[model samples]
Each structure stands twice: as structure tokens, then as C-alpha cells.
Target: MKIGVMGAGAVGSFYGALLARAGHEVVLIGREAHVAAIRQQGLQLSSQGETHTIPLHADTSPAALVDATLVLCCVKSPDTLQTAREMGPHLAPEARILSLQNGIDNLAALRSLLPHTVSAAVVYAAVGLAGPGQLEHRGGGELVMAGDALDAAGFRAFDDAGIAVRISPAIEEELWSKLVLNCAWNALSAITQIPYRALHAATGIVETMRAVMNECLAVAAAEGVQLDAALWSRIEGIAERMPQQTSSTAQDLARHRRTEIDFINGAILRRADAHGIPVPANRMLHALVKLLEDRPGLPG
Candidate 1:
């Protein structure tokens, strides 16, 4: 199997290395520095108390995706449309594209830009780039993929690569549930520059998270998405599941790069406004994150 990971940051590099290790041909389309490091010394993957340098194809050009059978779109939500447009001409006609991204809007955005059945995957992994061409996995590595278009070969390939995956018919609800979690935690983590365990242990944090999540749920209800009843429990349990892991938003802030906050909490804000539902909690978090993005040097 030839797999191309578009925007091969932490998540893409992690999965690409795993697939490559399983004997599949994997190419990572990433930033120049990361691509250069991979070209020089292969991709370095550190996970489960082990580190290995796995050799694979890496490029900064989308043309590297020309022959890929599976394409994982892992770019930030804001870059979805632009990345899709860049990679569109290079994708094989039969290539299976999966949006292994944060937020709820990326699936529709990609489908609109590409001429393929773009599947959505609710990714439950804590990964980050330790450095150029180096991926560090914190915890969790499961994917709940949308739709049944994944063939037997594809499923077997992912399984052989040590990736746990399951297809779900109700992916919209999954995406919303994940979004609710993001709305509840990402900004708080970003602002505090702390891991999930620390944040959850902070004073008044759980109640604040609940408030944000409830606001997001109200918006989800208005949009007619029937999220799972156990979603809140899942959200609260993230602190235990990935105790040392920080939110992707926190990682972005630490790197002084842009975040997907606009799509995560901001998505809720947009819908809430449309539905005339006040989401003050979501709004405050979104604004604070945006303020931080706009003023990266703002003193804590």
C-alpha cells in the first residue's frame, strides 16, 4: 500500500511511520525542515518507551501524493481547503482520503474541494512533534472512522500497522462529541500551558469545562446532531486517559504557531449565534485563544 500523509506534522508523521514500519510504502508531505530531516536520517518515532528511526519517503510537495492509495489529511482545520486544493491534482482517482483532523468542519470543507469520498475520522491520540522529523506519542491511538468505504485491504493494512480503527455510521455525532471535548479543554489547556491532569485538578476548572461543553451541546442539539449520552463522562475522563498530554492548542501556542481554535470552539460560537443560543463560556475561551494567537508575546 502506498500511503501519503498530507501535512505530516505530529499526527501524520506518527501514523505514517507506523504504516511504513508495517512494510507499506509511505510518503510524508510536510514542512521543509521536517522533510529535510527525514530525507537526511529518516523519521524518528518515539512511543511506548522506545525510539526508532524509520526510513520512509518525505517531501514538501503535494506531487508526492500522485501514486498514494490512502491519503491522510492531517492539516490544521484552517488549512483544509487550501491543502485540499494543492493536493487535489496529485491524488489518484481511487485514492481513499481520510480527514484525521480536529474540529467538525474539515470533512465538508475537503469534500467540497476534492472529487472523492472524503471520510472523517475522530482521532483519539496524543501526539506532538518533538523536533523536525521526530514524532513523540504521548497516549491514545485509536480512530473511529466514518463510513464503510474502507476496503478489506485498507483495514488490514491499518491493523497490521498497529493502528486500531473502527467504522461508524454516526460519524457526525462522533465529530460533535469530539468537538465538545475540544471546546471544553483545548483553550483552557492552551491558556494555562498545562497538561490535562493539572488542568482538571485546578480550582473551578471542571465546572468551567462543564459549562463550555453544555453550551457546545446546546448548539449541537440546535444543529440536530444526536451526540452520545456518555459524552460528558468521556470528556471528564480525558484527564485520566492522557494525564500528561497537553492539548494541540497548547502545543500550537507553545510553538507560537496558529491553532484550530476557530474551528473547534469558534464553530460552536458561530452556530450558537445563528441559533440565538448564548454560549458565553465558549465565546470567552475562543476569544482568549484568538487574543493569544494575535498577540503571541502577551505576558501571562
Candidate 2:
């Protein structure tokens, strides 16, 4: 089976390498540097203190996706529309596109832009770019796919690649739950440029997170998704479990790239506005992240 990974950044590269190692034909569509490096030397995958080089196809062009049987749409939320528009014409007619992105709206955003039936996956993974053509996997590599349009062959293929796959009846709830967590920490980590532990250690930070989370919960409720009662606890526990971890937003800022603040926290604010609920904390965080994105050189 031919698998194409669009936006072959950290998450896309990790899965593409693993699938390639499992003997599937994999092609990664990404930047020129990563594609060049992969063309010269196979993708470098590092996990659990070991590194492995896996041979695969790489290209900077969306045209390379024409032959893909399955396409993993892994671009950040901000790039969803453009990616869908660019890749839609190139995707094979029967090809399946699964959104492996953050934020709750990417699935709809892709479906609206593409002609094919797009699926959503609740991705549970921690991957980061080690360098060009390099992916470092930290932990948690499981996937929960939603909807009935899933291809049985695709499920088997992902399973064979050592990726856990399951069908969830309440995928929206799961997504909203994750959104709550992202709202709670991503902006805080990005603004302070600190890891979860340090962010949690700061005075009044946890309470501020609670304030943000309560608004998210209210918005989720208005949106007809009842989040888990343990959501707040899980949000708080993330810091303890991943003490040294920085939010993706923080990483984006550190790299001087665009952050998904608009998609994550900004989504919450939009929903709150529609429902006429107040989300001052979320609003402030979202605005502050945008400010930082616009002028990243701003000092404390």
C-alpha cells in the first residue's frame, strides 16, 4: 500500500517512518530541505535512545500524492484550508484522507475543501523534529478514529505498522476534552516560554488555568459536547506527567513559526461568543498569543 503524509513535520514523519519500516511504500510531502535530506539519506527516526534509518520516498510537491492510497493530513490547523485545496486535486479518487491535526475543526475544514470523505482521528502521540528528515518520538503513539467511512484495509495497515487503532463512538467528546487541555496550557506555556512544570509552579497559574478551562467547559456544553468530569484533573495532571514538555505553541514561537493559537484557544472564544458566554481568560490568552506571533521579539 502506498501511504502519503502531507505536511511531513514531526507527527507525519514519525508515522511515515514507522509505516515504511513495516514494509509499506511511504511518501512524505514536506519542505525542500527535509525532502532533499530524505532523498539523499533515508528518514532518521529516533526513539527510546536509539536511532534507525528507514528508506522511503520524499517530495516537496503535492503532485507526488497522486498515487497515494491513503493520505495523512498532518498540517497544523492554520494550514488546513490551503493544504486541502492544494492536495485535493492531486489525491486519487478512492484515496482516503484522515486528519491527524490538532484542534477540533480540522476535520470539517478539510471535508468542506475536499471532494472526498475525510475522517478524523484523535491522535495520541508526542513527536518532535530532530532535524531535517529526522523524527524523535517521545511516547504515546495510539490513534482513535471516528466515523463509519473508515477503510478496513487501512485499519489493518495501521495496525500492522504497530499503531493502535480503534473506533470511538464519542469522538467529538474526545476532541473537546483535548481542546480543553490545549486551552488550559498551550498559551500559558507559549507566553512564558516554559515547560509544563515551571508553568504550573508559578503563582496563581493553576487557578488561571482553571478559569480558562471552566470557560472551555462552558463552551463545550453549549456546543452540545459534555466533557468528562475528570477533564480538569487530567489537565492538571498533564503538567506533572510531562514536566519538561513544552506546548506545541511554545515550540512554534521558539522556532519563529506560526502557532495554532487561533485554532485552539481562539476557537473556544468564537464558540463562547456564539453562545453568549464570557471567556475572558481564553480571550486574553488567544489575543496574547497572536500578539506574540505578530511580534515575537517582544521582551518580558
Candidate 3:
């Protein structure tokens, strides 16, 4: 299989290298420093104290996708439309496009810009970009894909490449579940400059998470989406199991990178307004993250 990965960030490079290891021809479209590193020496996968090089092609341009049979849209939520435009003109007719992004609207955004068959993928992983051409895995790595349009061949191809994928009929629910989680922890932790562990250690922390999640649930209900029973207990499990981690949003702010508060909390606010639902909690969270995204770091 020929695969093209957009962004070549932590998530993109991690999956791209895994597929390459499984014998697929993978091409990563990333920044010049990382692209140069991958081209000079294969992509390096560092996880659980293991590191090795996986041979693959890398380029800084979307043109690298010309021969791909599948396109993995891995850019951050804000860049979805722009990245889709850049990769739009080069997509193959038969290539299957999968959105491995954080937000729910990313698939719809990409579909509007490109003619490719797009699927929403539910990502369950904790990985980061350690440096140029390098991926560091911190947690789980499994995927649940949207719809039946993707088949066993596709799953096998990716699984053979070490990236596991499953077909899901209720992908919207999955997205909302993750969205609520993101809302609960991402921006708050980021704003406070605290990791998940420290963020949860304070008083009213779990209560705070529930307050945000209840707002999300109300919004989801008004929008007529059903959440799985797994939400509450699953999120409850997070604090005890992995409380030390900060959100991707928090990490973005820490590095001075643009955060995706708009798509996450901002999305909720939009939907709440659309449905006449009250989302003061979400609105306030959105405002704080916006303030942080606009300003520099938390004060010294």
C-alpha cells in the first residue's frame, strides 16, 4: 500500500513509521528539518526505551502524496481546511482518506475540500514528537474507524503495518466521548500550566471535570447525539490511571504553538448556541484557552 501522511507531527510520524515497518510504502509530508532527517536516515521510533529506524520516504510538500493509495490526514484541527487544500490537487482517485485528528468536524472540513472518501477515525493513543523525524509513544495506540466503507483489506493493511484499526458504526458517539474528555482536561490543565497528575491533585478537580463534562453532555443531548455508557466510568478511570499527563492543548500552549480550543470547546459553544442550550462552563473554558492561545505563557 502507498500511504501519504500529512503534518508529520508526532501522531502522523508515529503511524507512518509503524506502517512502513509493516512493509507498506509510506511517505511523510512534514517540515523541512524533520523531512531532511527522515530522508537522510529513516524515521526513528522511540517508545518504552526502544529506538530503531524505519525506512520510508519523506518530503516537505503535499506533492509527496501523488502516488498514495491512502491519505492519512494528520494535521491539527485548525489546519484541516488548509492542509486539505494543499493535498487536494494531488489526491488519487482510489485513495481512501482517513482523518486521524482531534476534533469531530475535521472529516467534514476535509470532505468539502477534497473528493476523497473520508472516514473519521477515533484515536486512542498518547504519543509526542520528541524531535525532528522522531516519535515518542507514551500511551495506547489503537484506532476505531467510522463507517463500513473501509474494509478488512484496509484494516489488515494497516494492522500488518502495526497500526491497529477497527470499524465503528457509531463513530459520532466515539468522537463526542473523546471531545468531552478533551474539554474536561485539555484547556484547564494547559491554562494552569499543570500536567494531568497535578491538575487532578487539587480539590474539586474531579468535580470540576464533571461540571465541564455535564455541560458537554447537555450540548450533545441538544444536538441529538447518544453517548455510550462507557463515558463516566472511563473518564473516572483516567484520573487514577493517567493523571500526570497534560492535554495536547496544554502542551501546545507550553510550546507557544496554536491550540485547538476553537474546535473543542469552541465547537461545543457553537452547537449550544445552535440548540438554545446553556454552556457557560464551556464558554468560560473556551475564553480562557483563547486568552492563553492569544497571550504568551502563564506569568512567571
Candidate 4:
């Protein structure tokens, strides 16, 4: 299978390296620095304190991906619509493009651009770029693929990549579940500049988390979507499992980059208004993250 991974960050590169290892052809389209590094030295996959240098194909040009069987649109949420439009002429029509990203609306944004070839999944992995062409895997690489739209062959292709894959009958529900969990952690952790465990332990943290969760649930309900009630138990489990893990939101704000807060917390607020629902908790968290983003960092 020929796979075009549309980002060379830690998540995309790590998965690309794995598929390449599984004897499939993998091409990574990404930023200039990463392209140069992958062209010079093969992508380095570092995990569990061991580093392995793996040879893989890479390019900075969108045109380089003319023949991919699968296109993993792994760019950040805000980049989705633009990236899909850019890949419009380059994408193979038969390709199964997966918006393997953080939030739920990414696939919809892609579908609005290229309606025929987009899918969504709930990513269950933690990864980050260590350096140009270097990917560090922290944990979890499983994915729940969308059930209704994909073909059987699509499922096999992902399985061949060595990913723990599931063809979910209710993948949208799964996506919403992940969103609820993120609503609890991403903003709070980013605002506090603390890891999940520490942030959750702060004064009134449980109440705050639940407040956000309740707001999210209200919006979900008003939107006529059913979410898993057990989602909070899984959300709390993240703090227990990765005690020191800081959210990607925290990491992004630390680097002074834009967050998916608009989609995570702010999405609820937008949808609440559309659905005639009140999301005060989410509104507060959204504003707090925006304020935190505006405030300059402390002395380096």
C-alpha cells in the first residue's frame, strides 16, 4: 500500500515509519526543515528509550503525493480546510483520506472541501516531534476507524500498518467521547501551565472538570447527539495513567502557537448557541485559554 502522511510531526512520522517497517511504501509531506532532514538522514523513531533510524520517503511538495492509496491528513485542526484544498488536485480520487487529528470537526471541514474522500477517527496516541525527522512516541497508537463509510480493504490496509484498528459502528460517538475528555483537560492544563495530574489536583479541580463536562454534555444533548456516559471515568483515568503528562494544549501555548481550543472548548460554545443551549463552563474555559494565549510568556 502507498500511504501519503500529510504531516511529518511526531504523530505522522511515527506512524509512517511503522507502516514503512511493515513493508508498505510511505511518503511524508511536511514542512521544509523536516523534508531536508528526512532527505539527509532517514526519519528517526525513538520510543521506550531506544532510537531506531528508519529509511522513509519524504517531500515538501503536495504534488509528490499523486498516487497514495491512503492519505492521512494529520495536520493540526486549523490547517484542515486549507490543506484539503491544497491537496485537491493532488489527491487520488479513490484514496481513503482519514482526518487523523485531535478534534471532531476536522473531517467535516475536509468533507466540505473534498466531500468524497474523507473519514474521521478518534486518535488514541500521544506523540510529539523531538526534532526535524525525529519522532518520539510517548504512548497509545490505537484508532477507531469510522464504520459506515469505509470499505473492508481500508481496514486491512491500516491493519497491515500494524496499528491496532477498530471499525467503529459509531465512530462519531467515539469522537465526541474524546472531545468531552479533552474539554476536561486541555484548557485547564493549558491555563494552569501544569501537567494533567497536577492540574487536576489543584483547588476545586474536580468540580471545575465536571462543570466543563456538564456544559459539553448539555451542548451534545441539545445538538441531538448521544455521548457515552462513562466518558468522564475514562477522562479521569488519563490523569491516573499519565500523571506527569502535559496536554498538547499546554505544549502549544508554551510554544506560543494557536490551540484547537476553538474546536475543543470553543466548539461547544458555538454549537450551544446554535442549539439554543447554555455552555457557561465551556465559555469560561474558552475565554481563559484565549487570555492565556494573549499574555506573553515569562522570562526565558
The residue ranges of model 4 lying beyond 4 angstroms of the native Cα positions read 148-150, 296-300
lDDT of 3 by residue, 1-300 (tens): 788998888888888888888888899999899999888888888877889888899998998899788888888898898998898888888888888889789978988988878887887777877778777787678888775646556777776877767677788888889898888888788888776777777888888788889989999988889788678887776666565556788778877888889999899999989889888888888998888777845432
Q: Which of 1 and 4 is the better model by lDDT?
A: 1
lDDT, residue 167, model 3: 71
Task: Report the C-alpha lDDT of model 1 over 158-245, residue by residue, as the tens digit.
Answer: 9999999977888888888889999999999999999999899999999999999888888988999878889889999999999999
Sort by TM-score, best first: 1, 2, 3, 4
Question: Model 3: runs farther than 4 Å from truth?
Answer: 147-149, 240-244, 296-300
Which stretch of 10 consecutive residues in model 2 shows the poorest summed lDDT? 291-300
Model 2 per-residue lDDT tens digits across residues 54-133? 99999998999987889999999988999999998899889989888889999889988888878888776777786798
Count clashing residue pairs per candidate: 0, 0, 4, 0
Each model's Cα RMSD? 1.9, 2.3, 2.5, 2.5
Q: Estimate each model's TM-score.
A: 0.97, 0.94, 0.93, 0.92
lDDT of 4 by residue, 150-248 (tens): 567667766787888877888878888889989999998888888777777888999989989988888887777898878888888888777767787
Error of 1 at 34 (Å): 0.7
Clashing pairs in 1: none
In candidate 3, which residue pairs get closer than 3 Å at backbone N, Cα or C atoms, i.e. clash?
Answer: 196-243, 196-245, 197-243, 197-244
Off by over 4 Å in 2: 147-149, 296-300
Q: Which ten residues in a row have the lowest lDDT in candidate 3?
A: 291-300
Candidate 2 has an lDDT of: 0.88
Question: Which whole-number lDDT from 0 to 100 does residue 265 have in model 3?
Answer: 89
Clashes of 3: 4
Residue 255 in candidate 4, Cα distance off native in Å: 1.7
Which is the winner by lDDT between candidate 1 and candidate 3? Answer: 1
RMSD of 2: 2.3
